[model samples]
Target: MTDRRRFADAVFRGARSRRSLRTPHAPLVPRRPPAPPAAPSAPEPETGLETGEPVVFDAFTADLGAGLPTGMALLVVIPVEQGGTPGFRLRAVCCCASLVEFGDVYGRPDLALGSLVAADGLLPVDVLSSMRTWSRTKKGLIRWLDARRAAHGDDLQLVIWDQTGYGIPWELFWLERAPGSGRSEGWLGGLVTVTRWLSIETAWGEVVRDYRSEHTCAGPVAAYVAAEMEHDVSLFGAYHLENSDSLHTLAKALEEGDPLAMVYVACHGTYGARLSDCVLGGVPLDRFDPRRFDRLGPAATFVFLNACHSGSLVDDAGRFRDRALRGFAEVFLRSGAAGVLATSGRVGDRQAHEMADQLFRHLRDHPGRSVAQAVRDLRAEMARMTPDDLLDVDGPEGNRRLLPLLYRFMYVFYGSPRTAVSLATGKGV
Candidate 1:
């Protein structure tokens, strides 16, 4: 066996032994009452679109395996009190098996992870390297996941259900190099299909909806691009908004127009504590109410915020807030978006546009691939591309190499992992 295999074996053995000796902890009790049953699943009446069978969004239960789809595993990270001190409890559950690790205390490193990701103009590779090293040390949590990933292979979909407000970027966790595999090391997001979820109350209060059943890639698309990005208008075809500054108009349409399949925005995003302060395409995010999305019906409206800090959530002190603030991504999800693809840090304009192009092309080419899987594949694809492959080598200095490497890790997806887009033609609509 290789050294990596040996290490994994040791870790697995240790985990099993630890579990055997300790009593399994009780399930976490929900602070609020269980959410109401979701609207009954029904077929699309007008469009004759093949709306997949409806699946009710069940209330959050202590049983992680309850309602979990086959071939998908959930890694739930909850902040809990351990021995009168604050710590995190991690549970990895799938159809075949379940693993639980507790007493993983939070530290400065945990808090700093978010800061490093949200920082301006840092090399993404360096931040990813730091995350990888940190993952190695968390033998109880990350190592367990590594062992599970190795055992389960690449087909498993890892859904990170993180309740910890530490701003832990779970997707960036680096798994050790596979045994005997010549491929270089990769982060968790690149290696497997990953999606994220928060509590129902936190995401959309009293709004119980399953994005998988409601959302598909084959539908009308709405886009909000900046004036400078006019050249990229061909990306969305006829769906691109003519006036880039009309984000408010787009928001109104999303609220009142026909159920759109996807909402794509390519512009500048500023992160701030208040909703009014956080701006997307020069329009404060506060203008796009979650209720407006709630009115769009059950069609899975996936939003792609292709801008810097569009996916970030921070506080006045610039640290990851423990509370779930209604940020850009959250508002959409809460308002009933099937899923969201956003960036966690500052991204180069050219790189962001390229990432957007590659993403849409991938979804269009692969009709039935889930958004989560597409993101995973994209991350892997980007990781394999060299600086020369992605950029003009002689064009610029500074971040020529770093931007390509960094941008891949910046994307953070929020929503159902099973949500997919099906474009019969080149247009997103």
Candidate 2:
């Protein structure tokens, strides 16, 4: 236990320092510009999912507790093996109390995660069961949290710092009600505003540095929800850069524009047991060569990366791979975007689209809200939505009712926590 504490202490110290330091944007190295992309392929036919019933991405679990006391929180960093099954040694460090614990993950972490967040191949009941099973295995961690809550009171917040190659959905962990409280078990999202962060060295430093200029530029908001919403420029007001052609062209277009506000993307994403394998659309972010954007000059201040594993990173086996490549979220920050809202893994298309739309609505309707507050409000709003409001049908669909709650917890905000969206009219703060 002493040795574990010492190790966790070291990691916590490093995380603290990195959180404090900011990495200045590296000077753009002179290089040839990227080639133009081929014309966009014809739009595919709309699937029933897209034009189907409105999917309300709810984060509520029975009684979603009022968020932890403002600013008071816990940060847990878990070490994971490469290419290993989702199961891992639970060597975690808690920043709030400087607490550290070593243990094993519950059940087949991979299977539970797949059933809960897998993009395909699982029934709604299977998904719910998988989620419950995953949470059940974490009884040890829950006990630890219960102790902390008892000691520190209910105001303490919970923020998970994911450092593993296989991204675990921390939000799914179920916390039972206090003895005789007469309430059922509740997922972590219900009790607090649960958020996640990357633990790689370079990513943290870049976030610290880029965060300073997160809202420096005042530009129009841009978006590309889907092939159908491509021409809906009014969706975001002024600029709506459709995911036309390819991601390469989108990057090029944003590059040409002066310092812009934010770019929103909604598309299929893929992740592997390895964090480096994460991709947005069809482009792998880790393998993305900085040289590709070398000549680009547009600076997008913030991004809403509504893709799987876009905010994930693993500590390379050793110091050798410490900062080898940037995490998917950091890729945008390094490319001049100061902040990002990303998911740790694959999310259903319905939930993905709902998150994108609601996020924009909150940012637009409430300019006084910072990005963090906007997100919190968004989470709370969705959590507040009753089951009736979210359900289209009563019986069979109700079995999968938890889908909305699952997605609500998948989004993890990266970069400066205080940074908010700045619209072209300069209203959003």
Candidate topping TM-score: 1
Report the C-alpha lDDT of model 1 over 1-429, residue by residue, as the tens digit. 755344334322321110011111112221112221332111111111123334232343345565656667777665544334444546566756764534345532443332453222223345555676778877666555666666567777777766544567777777776567543456788888888765443433445345334357445667777776665677766453333356776777676655667778877666555556567776765565344564334666778888766775433223323233446776777667778898775565666777778887887688778888888898887667744233222222322444466567678888778888753334454
lDDT of candidate 2 over 218-275, digit per residue (tens): 4665554545334334456544333445565566666554556677765555544343
- At residue 144, candidate 1 shows an lDDT of 59
* Shift of residue 5 alpha carbon in model 1, Å: 40
Model 1 misplaced regions, further than 4 Å: 1-61, 80-87, 108-125, 178-185, 200-208, 211-214, 238-245, 287-290, 294-296, 314-322, 386-400, 424-429
Q: TM-score per candidate, in order?
A: 0.73, 0.61
Top candidate, metric lDDT: 1
Model 2 is weakest, by summed lDDT over 10 consecutive residues, at 34-43
Whole-model Cα lDDT per candidate? 0.58, 0.47
Worst 10 residues of 1 by lDDT: 17-26
What's the CA RMSD of model 2 in angstroms? Answer: 17.2
TM-score of 2: 0.61
